[model samples]
Target: MIDMDRKLGRWRLRVWGLVINLVANAIALFGIVAVVEGGSPALLIIGATLTVVCVAALAIPPRSDS
Candidate 1:
């Protein structure tokens, strides 16, 4: 029973992490588009850099065991 609970908790954490990453990625994409529409190369570059950082951060798994 305890093992099952632990597994469920891990699954929940993974799902939540995925959801957060997805939202962050979508926002970053939209930011890039907005920057392009506004005709600012600087903003576009910054947005793209931030998006890459955000996605990289999301891709990295936590160190501590659940």
Candidate 2:
């Protein structure tokens, strides 16, 4: 039972990580497009900041509770 619970927890974590990464990439893409299309600089700044933050988040290793 405990093993099953651990597996589920890990699966959930992976799914969330994938989702976060996808969203971050989408934001970065939008930012690039906006800049190319002469959109606001603020949009680029916000998107770049979020992308950096997301990259930092993904760079951290998951904690092992062993």
- Considering every candidate listed, which one attains the maximal lDDT? 2
State the lDDT of candidate 2 residue by residue for 1-66, as single tens digits: 122112445475445555776787777788788889988666667767777766666565555653
Candidate 1 regions exceeding 4 Å error are: 1-11, 39-66
TM-score of each: 0.45, 0.58
Query: What is the model-wide C-alpha lDDT for candidate 2?
Result: 0.63
Model 2, runs deviating above 4 Å: 1-14
Task: After the best TM-score superposition of candidate 2, give how far the Cα of residue 33 lies from its true spot, in angstroms.
Answer: 1.4
lDDT of 1 by residue, 1-66 (tens): 122112354474445545666665666677678776885556455556666655555565554553
> Candidate 1 deviates by what RMSD?
7.1
Query: Model 1 compared with the native: what TM-score?
Result: 0.45
